[model samples]
Target: MEQTYIKKILKTRVYEVAKKTPLDYATNLSRRFNNHIWIKREDLQPVFSFKLRGAYNKMANLSEDILAKGVIAASAGNHAQGVALSAAKLKIPATIVMPKTTPEIKVAAVQSWGAEVVLHGTTYDDASKYAQQLVEQQGLSYIHPYDDEDVIAGQGTIGMEILHEHSGKLDAIFVPVGGGGLIAGVATYIKYLRPEVKVIGVEPDDAGCLHAALKAQERVILDQVGIFADGVAVRQVGKLPFEIARTHVDEVLLVNTDEICAAIKDIFEETRTITEPAGALALAGLKQFIARENCNGCHLITIASGANMNFDRLGYVTERTEIGEKREALMAVTIPERLGSFRQFCHAVGQHFITEFNYRYADDEKAYLFVGVRLNDGLEKDRLIAKLRDKEYPVIDMTDNEMAKSHIRHMVGGHTQSLANERLYRFEFPERPGALLHFLTRMGQRWNISLFHYRNHGAAYGRILVGIQVPDEQLNELQNFLENLGYPYWGEANNPAYQLFLN
Candidate 1:
């Protein structure tokens, strides 16, 4: 039962496994971060994760008669594949009960490995109950994802390999934590062998079960869980793993969804290998800790635990990375409706990329702008509004304003196709005096407004939705001159949603 001896068994299990996974040295990260860095590439393992090590050990430890009876497991995704593949290798029957909401790809993978896949429940708790019932009814072994000793010992093999391949001393090892089995095993083994080696655990900030449980000095259940990192989105840490991690883990770092996405992009750029959100978490944690603690020139290793990514989810990943880098931030800015107010709005900041600019006019209130700003290094976020304030313009920070970003930004781009040709859009904008009259003077009487919708929403600049009926041939010429005026505009008529619903 002593964990120190578990490493010996893990070594035996390592020989049993057929995968000689590479402990890839990260050349790019080492040079960029100025640290000796390497990746423990368990993401490239045969089962595409370290889960198989635990799953296989648990199965092999069973008695001959118990093995004949088969095994059952309930997992959201990764562990199901682990057990399915492990049992199939042992020539024993395996039945995997997964949440119905589990991604189609993981389901197909489990079935391909010859496991009977039963889609049940919307959450892991429900699927687990179903698996327990099956264990009782069929007298089959209930193989846990990480709650058993044998499983822990098997997963410890990774720590052994890490030390074997990464020579000399290690300043710290960052690992992604879910239910704590991986950390429990790796931390326990590492601390026993190298007491000074820091074993830091990373958990999704939205679902910090292990971190919470370890802090409480007992396993605790979370009332809610986040599914962004589906593989690590557990509500509670297992009791057995909790015990090991509580005493061994040096620290627990919590990272958000955006940070995890950025880390995923970073690793993909480095190795050209895609990792699930959960897998990228260790590296996210490392960057987070280094920044917080101001660490430099330390030997660091991050375990990339799995690679079971939902391919379709890449679009969401791409979207979040824009926001994560602060290269693109969403916020609402109010500018008065007037002649020069529009020009003043552009002059507030020295230079920044405009990702999106949407405006709508209502009730002569201020013209509202939903703006996205591109981020660059050394450009602190707080400085933007200060520069605008110097110009006597007001900007509202909505970087964390999820509702305005997700829902409003999409609707604001809708086309003006609903307006009749005779309708005129006049810029009654600019809250400052002499602004609207100046705008009219600059237009040189060439424009006629058929429809006018302008609002000075108590802001410096006002926006108006203008519709003009000109010769169809004049479209390109008028647009070219409008661009010279230095205001951003979108042609909503070309939006896909315009064609689908509005048309």
Candidate 2:
């Protein structure tokens, strides 16, 4: 199977559209990590992603009859662009089925390649189902995003290029895993050639299909996946890719969204390139590996998979980068609600820079303040916590608290004792004009909105925290309303941060 894949990858016709991306050295990263760090610049491809390599390779291998009939694909992201461009280059009429929630920028990009775009369902699964129906109805060839053999081989060419460009003592190669095609292909080729060099797969901690599958020893579906890194938010790994990964892949590492954000900043510092969340997954994992293993003077390579980032999302990324890098600590401090309380707190803070502070009048006895403190290193958090304790100021570490960081930080308003039946919920919906209005309309004026907080992250989705007043008897009705609303939501009534500051 290895030799078969090797031969197929060697003969893959992806160059008809894909570029042989450079395995460029990362000078700044090397200096910081005290190792030779290199980045495979797959983001420089014509489609701004390595997806084109696999998409075009699969399309090119089709028989003339199949090619003449045109092709179809389902993606809300890079794969759609890859197939669109590939179809244009092959002079075939292509149709891409994307989720209705897909951002306008991506929809426009796919259309720019002269492909017919069909906006369907609200998720990749919906789009994929619609694409399958279209394929059956129109006799179009389906260009899968990452599950086919030819597609995997096409991606294998990346590994071939990496080895060809670098002849140094290579330690490990980090590849971002989505549906597993990229890592599957790269791992196969690299392991076959340089058996000693580790092939590590990186995945977002919230969307770790590959990591879960390896641990379970079988392909298992994730009940829910995070959409922050929309590119690799797959719930399940491909069957074939999982099989390849079971043996060929060395290790799989998971990094949180904050870690991924930090990696994006790191890549920009090293190469002046902005990459999508999934694109930075490998580098994030690489950084984690180095910090954990404490290895030095070893050659490490990370794939910069794609650069098709939503410009609006950069603000959110930048905001989280400091926390992700462990250079900032978010703390919840309690002080007496008196004139000199703030001054005393400031004295305790001393030389540490306060990056953020949020306080609202809650009660006369005590005041809860949400604060962000700059840290010189990761170890500073423990020391700062102790320092505040010594000053007799009660502090809670809110850096790793998702609810506090995502919603509470933006909302520090005092709790309302009047609204005793209020229920707190967090929701994520597609970002578009009138989206909030639509939500409100569906909510109907029956229930009183006691509290509401929302901030635009500039991504395809909008996150909102809502507190609605509903008696216990009407709880089921509220559930029914949320279900009919057709958006992802989480009940946060028991959230600790909300209790500490708001409730």
Candidate 3:
């Protein structure tokens, strides 16, 4: 059978790759899943992903005539590095076309593999179209990222290696889906050798084109893809790989940005390895499935496919980790007509830091405010709900909803006030210090500060507004204290009077 012959080549490739990589068991995940979970350590591949398997296999099998013509590929991640390293090894010049938005880290890593990197267009489709044109004009052999048979066979070798290394008892293999070459190759080999071994594909929820296509029984194109998992945010999966997946893959799961961030942080904390969001998708999917289905007492293997992470992106990953774990509570607080009511509301919130606060009174009636609080670590959502219900406050949890997190956090307030004249204050403090109360208590006048606003908004310090009646001369003493307090202070008393009337 053609499949049998291909498996033979995959067998040889598997032997070679196993000699090159480590089959390190992931103790943290294993303990949590109650299964002997192991990482293929493809991230430890010479090119930082399993992509080298396919690239080298394809190049090694190339005819002398084709080798002389060189090779080209369009990839924004592992495939680029794989092709670069493989072509360099085979002494074949390679040109890689990548999406313009590909991370600098990936681009630099691919270049380091000795391939010429051409950054073009905004998506993989754009670069891939350009690559096709180059194949015709430049007479270069175009290496389909995952569409070709050889590339799939090469990726299959990783599956062969897994069976050999893991005592031949893998319950399932989790693979991250992109162009689908990696999973296709892997799934084909997995099905041929161990038909029952589940091959699950993980995809970004924002770019689950493959899963969408599988459901539709045809190719589907996404109009927009999330760039957070830039490496695997493919708008569509390859036709050939899709065929292989439709037949052999057991399931495909979609993970959102928060889940991917949680997986990335989990790996970093447990193994001290940082992976790109796409690389973490498989683990995120596994965690979701395990939680929803109780996948305990079963062996699972995850391919931490790549690690070419940009240093700057780590901050966003860390910031979203809380959101992923549901440890940050975001809400819009609506306050009614009363003076000590604001003070009572403050007292009502127990054991939480006000991470963000914004306030404005549209009319004389009600003030709309945005409030975010840092939940105590390990607090249960039900307890949080109960705590909020016990108080005379309305708390709607937007932690799990992405639409709410991005847009709602911005538009959470609406105007309910009819009276206008509100005051604004611009206060600047050192990057630190008890800036809020320190400024508030220093005012020395109880002008009934009507509105307040602040966002723990990652600024050098912070900004807030206090709608207290403008005490023209009292500001001098206030300004004196702020200046002596070693921070910049500006009185916004000159704020345009009518700006307040517009709500």
Candidate 4:
């Protein structure tokens, strides 16, 4: 079976539209890790993504009769642009169905390529169903994004090129996986030719479809997936790609959104090019792998998968990169409300850069201060906390606290005594013009909103921290309301940060 892919990959027709991107050595990354780290520049392709290779190859293989009938595809973003450009090059009609929640930048890119864009439901699965229905009704051929043999073979060209460039020197190749097409193709080809080299798949921790499927020994659909790395947020791995990945991929690594953001910063520092979260996934995994294995002086390669980043998202990425890299520590400190207290706290912090400092005088005896200090690493944070403890200053580390990082840091004010039976919850929902209004309407004046904080981070989703007052007897009713709200939410009532500043 591996030999079959080997043969197919050798004959792939991706060259018609796809370029043989260079394998560029990352001198800075290599030096930092003490390993020879190289990046496969799939991001340099004309379409700014490797999806063009597979999309073009699959379209090229279709018969003239079938091509004349046109092709259709469903994608969140990258694949839609790939199919649209491929169809434009081949002078064939193409229709792309994309989720209505797709970023506006991506939707515009698909339209710019002259394809018929059909905005469908909220997720890829919904758009896929609509696209399949169109195939039967409109007499069009459907081009599966990652499930087809031809497409996998096309993506295999990257593996072939990597080997041709590096030969047998590479220790491992890290591939970003959504539905497993890229890793399936690369692993199949590499294992058949040079079985010694490892092929690893990387995924966002919140959207680890391939990792989950490989662990279960069969396909398993995720109940929910995070949208930060929207490009690779698939609920389920493709049937064929999952089978190949299960056999060939040596390991699967999961990286968090913050890690991905740090990787994007790493790439930008080296190349002056910002990558989307999914695009930086392989590098994020590579860093984690190097740390876990204590690998050094080894040759490693990771694919820079795509560069179709939304310009507005860079702010959110920058906000998390410092914490991701362990260069900053967020903390909450309680000090006596005295004239010399502020100076004492600053003296305790020493010469470390103060990135942020927020304090509001609440009580006559004590006050809580939300602060951020530059740190050399995680160990430095611990030492600082120890010093503060010796000085009898109560401190709570907020670096890893999601609520503290996302909302509470920006909101530090006097607590209200009039609000009784208050419960706090953080929610994430699709960001649209009337989305907040719709949510308020759904609440239907059942409970009073005691506290609320929201800021647009220019992401596809909106995050909000809401405090609602509900009696103990209405706990079941609150659960029912959240279930029907159709939005992801987490209770923060027990969070120390909330108790310290808001309660």
Candidate 5:
């Protein structure tokens, strides 16, 4: 069965539009990691992603009569562009159903490729359902983003190219997983051709569909997926890809948004090319794997999958990269509200660069300061925290705290003692025009919104920190409301970071 796929991969006619991207050695990354780091520059493709290979190959394999009927696909961005460009090149009409929450840049890109861009739903899964409906209604050929044999074979061509370019002993090859298409294809080829080369799949921790599926020994639908790495923010692993992945892929590594951001910085430093969060995922996973296994001097390969990033998203990436690389420390420190106290606190912090400092006069006795200080490494955070604690400053380490990182850092003022029965909850909803209003409307007038904070990270989903004044008697009602709201949320009422800074 594997041999048949190998043959199919060999015969994939992706070269009609897809370029054979280079396997460039990452010199700076290699030196830093003490390993031979090679990057498969798939981002250099015409569509700025590897999806074109699979999309074109899948469409190219279709009969001319079927092509005349046109094709339809549902994708957030990269895959949509792939299908659109492929259809344009083949002179086949294509209709791409994208989520309404998709970034405008991606929508414009798909439209530019001459595909009919239908904005629907709030997520790729939703768009997929709509696209499927069109496929049935119009008798259009549906080109799956992944899961198809021809598509997987087309992606497998990347593995073939990798092996051809670097036939040397490679310890591992890391591929970012979304629907498990890229990893499945690459892993199937690599494991068959070179069994010794560990084929690892990397996924965002918030969207660990592949990881969950692997653990469950079957494809499992995630309740919610993080849209930070939108290219790979799939709620469920593809059926066929998951099947292939389970058999061949060595491990699935979950990396956080910060780690992915850091990886993007790493790629930028080495190649001077900025990659999207999903594009840098494999590198982030490779770094984590190296640290966990303490392996060095080994040849490691990671695919830089795509560069179709919105220019605005860089702000969020830049903000998180330092913390991700252990080069920044965030803390909430309480000092006496006195002129001399500030001087002493700065003394304790020492010569470190202050990245952020937010303070408000709380009371006569004590004031809370939310601060970000630069650090050299992980040990520096411990030392800095220890120094602050030793100085008798009430210090709360906000490092690794999601609540602190996402909302509390920006919202440091207006802690209300008058607002009784206030419950804080962090919410994630599809980012669209009426999303927040829809949320507020569904919340109803029964509960008063005491506090609300929203920050756009240029992702498909919008994150909001909300404080609602709910009486103890209405706890069940609040639960019911949240359940019916159908949005991912977590009660941050008890979060220490919220208590330390925002409260």
Candidate 6:
């Protein structure tokens, strides 16, 4: 099996459309981690992602008759651009079915390649179903994003290039896993040649299909996947890729949204380039592995996967970077509702930089203060909390509190004493134009909105927190309404942060 894939990868003509991306040395990261870090610059590909290699390879291997009938693909963004460009290069008709919620820039990029863009549904799965229908109806050839063998072989060329570029002692190579094609392909070639070199796979914790599959010893579908790293937000690993991964891929590591954000900043500091969350995934894993293993002066590599980032999303990434790096901490501190009490609390927090402070008077005796403190190290947060406690100030660590970080911090003083029967929810609203208005229309003024907080993070989706008043008798109606609304939501009525800062 290894020999067959190795031969196929070596013979693949990915170079017709995909360039051999350079393996770059991250000097800053290398020095900080005490390891020689090499980054595979797949983001520099013409289509700005490694998807071009697989997309083109799949199309190129097609029979002349199939090519004449045109090709079709479904993608949220990156793969769509890859297929569109490949079709243009081959002068064949191409139809790309993309999610309606895909970023505008990506839709334009695909259209720029002369491929017909069909904005079909709200998710990649929906678009894929429509694409399959079109494939059968139009007699068009389907180019899968990551499943087919030809596609995997094309991706395997990256492994071939990596071995050719760095002849030194490479300790490990980290690859980001979506549907597992990249890892499967790279692991196959690397294991076949340099059997000692480890091939690690990285994935976001919320969308770790490959990790879940490996643990189950079979392919398994995830109930839901977080779309923060939309490029790699797959719910299931492809069957072929999972089979390869079960045997070749060394291990899978999971990183959270904040860790992924920190990695994006790290990549920018080194390469002066901002990568999407999924692009920075491998480097994030590499850093975690280095810290866990306490290895020094060893050669490590991570693939910088893609650069098609939404400019609007950078603000959110910047906000989370410090927290992700464990250099910042958030807390809810309670003190006497008097001037001298604040002064005493400030003295307790002496010399520590305050990144944010929010205080609101709930009564004449006590006050709730939401504070963000910059920490020199992760342990400093504990020290600061201890100091505050010694001063008789009640403090709650809000650093890992999702409600505080996402919504409560933004609306700290929105407590209402007169409102009743209000329930809180966090929703992922599609970021398309009029989406909010559409949500309002669906809500239909049936229930009174007690509290609403929305701040655009500039991705394909909006993080929204809403408080709706529903009488006890209308609980079933509210549940039915949310289910019919069709957006991912979580109830936060009993969230500790909500109780501390808002309730």
Tens digits of per-residue lDDT for model 6, 240-340: 99989988888999998888999999999999989989999999899889978999999999999999999989988998899999999999998898778
Model 5's C-alpha root-mean-square deviation from the true structure amounts to: 1.4
In model 3, what lDDT does residue 315 have?
67
Q: Candidate 1: global Cα-lDDT?
A: 0.74
lDDT of 2 by residue, 238-265 (tens): 9989999999999999999899999999
lDDT of 4 at 105: 87
Q: Write candidate 3's Cα lDDT for 1-503 as tens digits.
A: 34853554454443343235666788887886677777767777877777788777777777999998989999878788888888777787999998765656778888986889998875567899999999999999888777877778877777777877876576888999988988987888778878888999999988898899989999998875666786786788998888888889999999888889888987776678898787788889887777777777778888888887767667667767876766666664556656776777777676677776666555566555566677765466557556665885665555664434533354434442444444555444422445566666765564556656554432223444445554565666544655665443445545322132223
The true-versus-predicted C-alpha distance at residue 278 of model 2, in Å, is: 1.1
lDDT tens digits, residues 286-390, model 1? 888777777778889999999988776786677677666556776666678666766778777568877778765532535556677787742556678677767
Backbone clash count, each prediction separately: 34, 0, 5, 0, 0, 0
Candidate 2 lDDT trough over 10 residues, lowest sum: 410-419
**Can you list the residue pairs that collide in candidate 3?**
363-417, 363-418, 363-419, 364-418, 364-419
lDDT of 2 at 369: 92
Task: Select the stronger candidate by lDDT from 1 and 2.
Answer: 2
Candidate 2 clash figure, as a count: 0
Candidates 1 and 6: which is better by TM-score?
A: 6
lDDT (Cα, tens digit) per residue for candidate 5, span 392-438? 98888888899899888888884566768889999997878989889
Candidate 5: global Cα-lDDT?
A: 0.90
Candidate 1 Cα misplacement greater than 4 A, ranges: 1-15, 404-406, 413-503
Q: How high is the lDDT of residue 251 in model 2? A: 92
**Candidate 2 Cα misplacement greater than 4 A, ranges:** 432-438
True-vs-predicted CA distance for residue 137, candidate 3, Å: 1.3
TM-scores vs. true structure, each candidate: 0.80, 0.97, 0.76, 0.97, 0.97, 0.98
- What C-alpha lDDT does candidate 2 achieve relative to the native structure? 0.92
Scored against the true structure, residue 272 in model 5 reaches a CA lDDT of: 85
TM-score of 1: 0.80
Residue 114 error, candidate 5, Å: 1.2
RMSD of each: 15.1, 1.4, 12.5, 1.5, 1.4, 1.3
